[model samples]
Target: MIPIYKPYMPQNIGVEISEILYSGQLGFGKYGREFENKLQSFIGAEYVLSVSSYNIAMLIVLSTLGLREGDEVIASPVSCLASNQPFAVKGLRVVWVDVNPATGAMCPDDLKSKITKNTKAIFHNHFCGYLGDIESINAICNSFGIPVVDDGIEAFGSQYKGRKLGNLGTDVTVFSFQTVRLPNTIDGGAIVFKDKDLYEKALLIRDYGIDRTIFRSSNGEINPDCDIEVEGYAGLMSELNSYIGTRQMDDINSLLAVQKNNAAIWNDKFTNLDTINSLKITAGCIPNYWVYGTLCKNKTKTIKDFKEQGYYATGVHINNNIYSVFNNNVSLKGVNEFINHFVAVPCGWWFENK
Candidate 1:
């Protein structure tokens, strides 16, 4: 069977992890700092904070906005639910917006139509590392002065015109270095902020208000109980993970080259299939090819038929509105369409010729 979405933990990782363990700085410290800096430069963001998980990053990004109940956050229902979970948990009403079926991106017109006075912000994902209509998304958000929080988890190297995805028109963008991404890091995520002050606030909020120091020194003596503000979550990524992620970043470009090359091959092959439709991308957009998903001609039985032939195709993501409590509460037409027909074929390691 050709399994889908496998992590390519290279040969050098074992030794590298061993060295980090031996260094005794195995927790979040220098390695995390180094990793964050590298990531900041790579994504062209002002600052990056290494966090425990993308979920934690999601939580912080939502909470930092100071949203309250009844406040609405317009979000594309096409992408992963991790993008919306934070907002939902914060008591903000999630106004589900549909994506353009062609680009799989949130329509700027939809943003204008869906946003009411209660709308606090808009959350849009770069579906398959393809940049959305940033000009209009930016202009609309800026017009209302509401921030745009982009879920760029799948768009690590995606670019628009020339600039990286994270830097384009977003108040902030969240990236995941999970076991499956353009470059997998086993477990890590980051929140990239354009403004230095907002970025530092996120940094403080990430690490229990601890910034650049843990314990204070009184004339060379240790000063205890010199606490800063309310201690936040222990969201710092461990040094071991950071070391792994840092090393992973070094090979990211080459790794994605392979993935994209393979995606082109898959796209060509799927073109001849009368029974399936190949996915499409924006003209100038270069996808990280995150998951390399496609839709089944028949939603219910396509996955089963594919698996019967020893292929590991399945629905790529979950529809949040289907999670028990939401069944009768809201109607998600676009979300339903995506979750049903959308199928993800393995990218990194499943290519027959790779």
Candidate 2:
């Protein structure tokens, strides 16, 4: 049976990994810097930082935001837990922004209605790698002088308008390189910053808040003068993960092309099916097509039928509000509609070989 998601590993990765394992420089070093540089070039962003995973990437972005307890953040209810859980863990209140059932993305109108003086930032999640109305979301947040944090975990290679998601005027964009994502590095992530100051701050805070530029004297001895300005977490990516990421970057373009081509085929096949309605793609955006999502009248029946035909299918993401940890009870009309019918099927590069 074909599965809905698959991790792509380069055939030559064993040789590359063995080389790094034997080099004795297993920590963040040349390869980590190289991976960050590659990401900067690909995303057309001025500042990029490689981290251990997407969860750590979000924490690093939150560190730069300077948000206090109880500050409200506008975010979609329909997204992976990795996208919104960081806010709750940071003691910030998450104000749910309803999604457009047609697209499975945040509804700009709902966002406009929810903003208030308590709103510190807006977290824009690109659902299933399908682009959202970020232009409108940016315009709304800009009026209030709020920053926008793009949760690009599933949108690593997606292009919005003419630029990539990270470089599209958002204040911060975080990407996931975890297994099953387009460019898997075993498990890793990256952050792209629009502000140079924030980028510098992240550099210091990513590894115990020590200033690497002057932490050691000219003779390689620890400087007694170095002071820890801000306490930080251990979030930097390791040299091993970085080496794998650099290798994966080599084939990113072709990997993306195959997913797009497969999605187009699925789109055509389901177009005339009266029981199935495909999700909509935003205008001027080329999605990475992490999975081919569709809405049906009976999600359970559809999934079972696919399984019987030797294909895996199911609801990929559940609305975060349903969990008790969030403690949210607001009823959202669009979210209700989306949760009822949304289901995903296999649409990765692996299908090409099958």
Model 2, 173-224: lDDT tens digits are 9999999897888899999999999998998878889898889999999998
- Candidate 2's C-alpha lDDT? 0.88
What TM-score against the true fold does each predicted structure earn? 0.88, 0.97
> Where does candidate 1 have its weakest 10-residue lDDT segment?
321-330
Global lDDT of each candidate = 0.74, 0.88
Per-residue CA lDDT of candidate 1, range 168-227, in tens?
758888888788775566877888887787777787778766654655675755456656
Which candidate gets the maximum TM-score versus the true structure?
Answer: 2
- Residue pair clashes in candidate 2: none
Model 1: colliding residue pairs: 27-239, 208-232
